[model samples]
Target: MSQPKDVEADLVFWRRLESQRMEVDFTKMAPEKCMAAMIEPDDVRTVHIQDIRGKETQYNLKLNGFQYVWHDMPELDGVAEQSHVENVVVPKTEALRELSLIIWSRTGATRTVTFAHRVRCLSEDEAMLANNRAPAHSVHSDFTPAGALKNLESVVPDVAEREELLKRRILAINVWRPLKTVQRDPLAVCDWATLNWQEDRVTNRMVLPHGWHELGKYAFRESQGWYYLSEQQPQEALIFTQFDSESEQADEGGMTLPHTAFVVPGTETLPARESIEIKMFAFL
Candidate 1:
């Protein structure tokens, strides 16, 4: 028998269309759950079904699925930071079509994040279309609760007393980064609030070294998030911001953000290195 030659296939055909891009970050989902088992329909995000893929596809996530969430630094923490590994759901869509997942983060002062997708083929049994390959990236977006405390204060009445109760009840908060990477950190930034705080318990601070480098004099302030590139090998790195929830009870003991934006080490005027990357997937 003659030996058959191995054929190579074009991987580019499997990409997703750029126009279909949607925000998938975990920070957009409200009443987020963590490390919990799936249960009621409310526990999931209902994704409407469509014939875009062909088959009468009904796409929904299993109960208690894992997800990555983002949010602003806690009211107690000053910098803009991100939270990860939050549980989320894809609401049931009236018409079902295959969905893509992605993770993204920006660095430097300004960033131009771009992604691409392409359709592969249609499935006969499934009666829907399928991508030869999944998109390079997808996000698990968040839905933060708006006016969680404001509404509570309205019911309670006493301004100061209501404020204290709301702050203590705030399990977490989420924030978004509107600008892309540039050559420096944003000097003035605004973070969205979940539970409003009247007191200065939630903070913001910035620090700089003096003289000929103060050895361990890290920035300690003015950082929204943190990043480390394997390409750069330096045992020492600066801590932009830190949140301590010792006084108030927080969700699983921390805060959340949309995504961690990175900044280069050393001088504060250099564009961040772009070696860091995120890969997405859907389990069988």
Candidate 2:
């Protein structure tokens, strides 16, 4: 059920009372300031983790608190190629929609899943170029309560429809898969059951690329329990919640999941990591 813990991974943690800010010049497609010092050596910690293979072990989104799914889509095999993605937006969207449906069925929730327009693909080589669109290395969830509300508004547009949608149980789920075989720099996620959201998560500002207002970001907590799946292949997908509308669910550890890309010690010679992540909204 677990792998060896001899290997350590470096993750970005938040310092107490540390104020961090970032500004991006979309015109230049770059960050206006060096966002490095926002993370300090003191803020970085090494934790031992082993990858859990979903095929061999069982993980439930509501029960085990996370889901490592075997989602194989041949249409997405060439997703790493920018040209291929750009040319096949329609097929990509359809494929993602099907993926969301599969997640909903597996969760056993009587809900409708709406695919979000925001989909991202990242590569370690491109991230080293400081292009702003990089695999997030910090330990945090994708959205806070306020951020999730704002996102819903943006997607719905109509006031009455948005309000109606808000009355139901809403969840933001991310479907993630590696573009190639992941040899190093794999993603690590914190078990929701172990997270103390109130004391562990701090609100930070995130200035996204393009002309968008600053959004809320969460900082890391040391008490969190982190896990990863070793040698995650292209055929598998990891699905987790970014936001859950139900407040009481937090007590049961089925709310938001915090995750980040971490360097797996001693795999430096392996190929750099490339992955695609798509966000979907599920209403129950």
Predicted model with the maximum TM-score = 2
Residue-level lDDT tens digits of model 2 in 89-177 = 33454455456446545443354445442233444424432243556777767766666676777777899988888887777777777
Least lDDT summed over 10 consecutive residues: which range in candidate 1?
A: 87-96
What C-alpha lDDT values do all the predictions have? 0.20, 0.61
lDDT by residue (tens digit), candidate 1, 202-252: 211111121110000011122211121122211111111112122132342
Candidate 2 Cα errors over 4 Å, as ranges: 1-6, 18-31, 34-42, 54-57, 81-133, 207-222, 251-254
Candidate 1 RMSD to the correct structure: 24.4
Q: What TM-score would each prediction reach against the true structure?
A: 0.18, 0.75
Worst lDDT run of 10 residues, candidate 2, spans 123-132
Q: What are the RMSDs of all candidates, in order?
A: 24.4, 4.9
